[model samples]
Target: MSFGLFQREQRSLFGEILDWMLTPLLLLWPLSLALTWFVAQGIASKPFDRALEFNLQALTQFVVGQNGQVSFNLNAQARDLLRADDSDLVYYQVLDSRSQLISGEPDFPPPRDFETPEPGRVLLRDDLVRGDEVRVAYTWLARPDPERLVLMQVAETKGKRSTLAAEIIKGVMVPQFVILPLAVLLVWLALVRGIRPLNELEQRIRARKPDDLSPIEESAIPQEVAPLVSSINDLLARLTASLTTQRRFLADAAHQLKTPLAGLRMQAELAQRETDPVEIRGSLQQIARSSARATHTVNQLLALARAETTGRTLPSARIDLARLVRGVVQESVPRALEHGIDLGFEGPDHMPDDCLMDGNPILLQEMVRNLVDNAINYSGRGGVVTARVLLDPFSGVQILQVEDNGPGIPENEREFVLQPFYRALGTNVDGSGLGLAIVQEIAQQHGATVLMEDAHTDRSQRGLRAAVRFMPKTPRQE
Candidate 1:
């Protein structure tokens, strides 16, 4: 029952501690009792053995021998002293060297072992005689002739020693029966007090509102728990920033969509009122353009959201930079041709087969498309927009670049353009302004750097160049 009582209930820290402390104490208690009992027996038997020695010596003095024969005759007064123990029966024996009982009890047993006890010394041992446990003390008396020496022995039943040993045991162990339970009670109380703080902490957490995200107080927390509190605080700060960004994005999207939708409604009304065929056609054309712009803005907003999401959780795969850039450039070529802008890839038609790196393919493709789209949109007509995937010889880095003969962003305004919905002033391009912002966020997630510089230094035709340099990794090379 004791071995598994704790296992039947849910595990408890307190119970485990008690088991560790108390099990050894309980198992050793009986062993300690047995050892104490043996020691008590030795203590109680000391006085009795001494008394037996005295009787054996007294009986030795009564030894008499005449004519080469020996006998023991105790007078009444000395014999009464020998039988003085009230609680136990006593017996005596005297024997000649030839093993014949010369006097005292005729049936008394002699000492089983004796090597002629030295002079006046008394020897004591325990033995059973006549079906009763008894202690025996014996001494040998010397005669004029060494061959006729006599032996004297005295024996007593063990009742007095047994009683004294029981008293010693009771005296030693009774106090422990009272103190052991008190000690266990004190330990349990201390454990309960020691663990009270954790219960209070759990209660405090449960009492909080479900929507509460405030940081836990570090000052009140124990040093062991402070790191957990700090981590929770960090998570809350990030979530607050994410929520703010989401709200602002929603507002911007609503504002951007409002303008185009109103224009579409106005253009539709204009077409309904106009009777002239040319004017009606022009209004319908305006309506079509407004719808196209709205669609393009929606797609750009979706791309920006996906870019933000991917920035938080980046997924990787082996991406061939040259192949991905070529595909994105081809997709943007029709738009480039519509504006009469010369759009072409500047590097090898097929880059080195080893031009590969780890990246999220979809996000990387979106980044390239945004860069090329920005170039084609602002470069106007008769300008070249080139997309390149080149490897740097010195650094062994793979670089993706988009160069255009467009009005380059001024040095002072370069940082602002990477922010959401930020457009440089004095430019007439119609854009949702999230293109480069999306590119910057995705680039950050891939551990790449974005650099902006002039494609040409000529004052009349200084063009903007945007480049992304990937951190180098050794690729499989044949």
Candidate 2:
């Protein structure tokens, strides 16, 4: 049963601490009581033994032998001197060499024999008498008579011994009992004070405004919490940068959309005011063109916003680069024919089904479509715009290049054209200028690289070659 109890789960930290503190006090309490009893017995027994020895010695002085007859006597003065105080009851016995009682109580046991007894050598032992425990001590008395030797034994009840011992233990341990609680209280107080700074820091953070991106003041914070505060401040800085970019994008988008809308409205008013059939037809044609441009610009703006706002964490799947390129080419074919530009795709004639990359198909299509559109729009009559998708075996990259043969961007203007709302100086075509920027954003999200390089060293091609190189789904090992 005791072993089974030991296998049970014990209590937690606070319970364990309380048990540890109180266990020693409870255990040592009994030990203290026992020690008190022992010391009290020894102290109380000492004087009784001495008086008994003195009485035995005094009675031995009365010993006399008249012609081999033995007689013993004790005086009244000596008997009166042997009485004890009210707190303790003392008993004594005197025995002759033959183990016969010469005086006092005969029921007391005789002292055990020692080979060589020394003067003042006391032998003390405990015994049960009438169901009460008692302490006894005995000493030997030597007389002038050669044959007359006496043994003295003393016995006392344990009441006075227990009382004196209890008092002694209380004197020693009372302060310890008082000091232990005080020590625990001090430890609790210190812990509360030590955690105050952390509470204050939490309150300060909770009190902050939602848009407040300022760095926290670290000087006032405790050293232990400074690292946490620094991390929070770094997060705030990143959030501030993201918010600033978003606000700039919104402002630019509104400004760009306003121009096409105003042009559409003015065309509509002019058409309403015309009366001649030719002039009215001309005004209507202008309105139609303006409205078409406005609609196209709006579509491109929406695509750009989607590309910019889409999270990079959107699920990536294996995309067939050849199929994607062919689809985009088909979509742009009509637009290409309208401008008198020859548009074609060059790759494995059958379209390599395994030319794959890890990317979002919609964003990938948008990237390819914008690049091709930009090429066709820039190419002049009788110009060739080629869309090619190649899986480079050596570099482990999927490369897409859209090249045009008319009015290629100058070396100085190529970088500027990629910026939002930026248009080339000589371009007369209506455009939102967000197409290439959207393409660049999508490419960046996919870990792809875009390069605007010369199609031919002679620069006779006249139009830009925009290429996006994507990392292959399965890269070749070095």
Candidate 3:
């Protein structure tokens, strides 16, 4: 059976590293044993094979060439030498040129027939002698006749070689069992020490207070982990800025709502104290006006907040800029007529191809409505307010412009008017001062730029023109 190194989901870095390190060591252990066994077998065979060759050469002395015929004659000392081993049986055979067995162990196998009969070369092979496996060493001896030769052979059982090979394998394999476990232990300890710094970083983050938006220290972290720390620091900075903006927005909203709330309280108390019907009606009317002003301020605050928050997350689609603007202008016609100002849309009768853009339609509508409403409020009676959507023929950039012939903002104050709750001086308009701010936020969300400039070149006919330039869509967007 085999086991995989990474058999499950890698949930821990430590486990993963340990598995990679130890799996190879464990898997190669068996392979190492196999290779050691092969080497040991070869080591055990060399001396035994040399001894067999020596005995075969010794037996050659007994083969005599008498009158062109071979005969074997062994002395008592040589016979006792062959039979001396108690652990294993030894055997020998002598064959003359006629393929006749001359003496000793008649069942001993012959040499391979295909071998060219050389004069005095010894060869070794494994064969069965009397049904027992034995190692054989044989040689061809030259006779007087050129084509005839005598064969001498000796063989022995494999008891000593088998014992020596077993000893070698035991010596090589016994220590690995103990060393493998120690190696695994050392690798585990090293990985734990290597990842100690990451654990320390985690503890530091966990100890931080809920309101702590400070950056993490990058210099103390490992070089490999420094990029992760830098990204965390960037996120912390953005979160701090967002929190600060929310605090300031809440403070300003409270301050702006105070005056209308105070007026409502004052008018209610005055109406309660008045006895005359006409005076009571006048107090009630003042109270109604204060409530309306408060309502308008609250609505503007909500719109500005929505533009900042929702515009970032809302999915956008291709919208017809001209048609959207025309619809907003048409909706504001009643308000324009009430103010006695001419509210007219100047653009193509139908939506043009270039006028199509990708934007959140609800946010775009709020932006255009704010522009039109702001113009109607600031432009007094008999003033002309023109809202137009035009496509620049050369650049293909779509533009929405609202021009009003009224008391325009001074060149120095143009940038300041785009900020929330900043109303221009000498304007009697009742506004929450958030219209242009909403316009700016919405324009940023849709990748457009807002510019405030004079409607006419002549300084005497000073009128404000607020233009939103929508950047041309890329090929992918198209």
TM-scores for all candidates: the values are 0.69, 0.63, 0.85
Provide the lDDT at 191 for model 3: 90
Better lDDT candidate (1, 3): 3
lDDT of 1 by residue, 304-398 (tens): 99888755676688888888899999998899989999999977665554566778999999999999999998899988999998986555588
Q: Write the per-residue lDDT of candidate 3 for residues 1-478, one digit (tens) a residue.
A: 1234766553776666677788888889999999999999899999999988888887787778878877787798578658747667799888778878888778889878787778899999999998888899988888656588888888899888888999999998778878888888888898999999999999999999999999998877888789999999999999999999889888888988998999999999999999999999999999999999999999999999999988889988889888899999999999999989999999976656655688999999999999999888888999999999888766668899999998999989999999988999998888888899999999998889999999999998968999999987763233
lDDT, model 1, position 403: 97
What local distance difference test score does each model get? Answer: 0.83, 0.74, 0.88
lDDT ranking, high to low: 3, 1, 2
List clash counts for every candidate, in order: 0, 2, 0
TM-score of 3: 0.85
Mark the 10 consecutive residues where model 1 has the least summed lDDT. Answer: 1-10
Top of the candidates by TM-score: 3
Instruction: Output the better candidate (2/3) by lDDT.
Output: 3
lDDT for 418 in candidate 3 is 94
Off by over 4 Å in 2: 1-192, 199-211, 349-355, 472-475
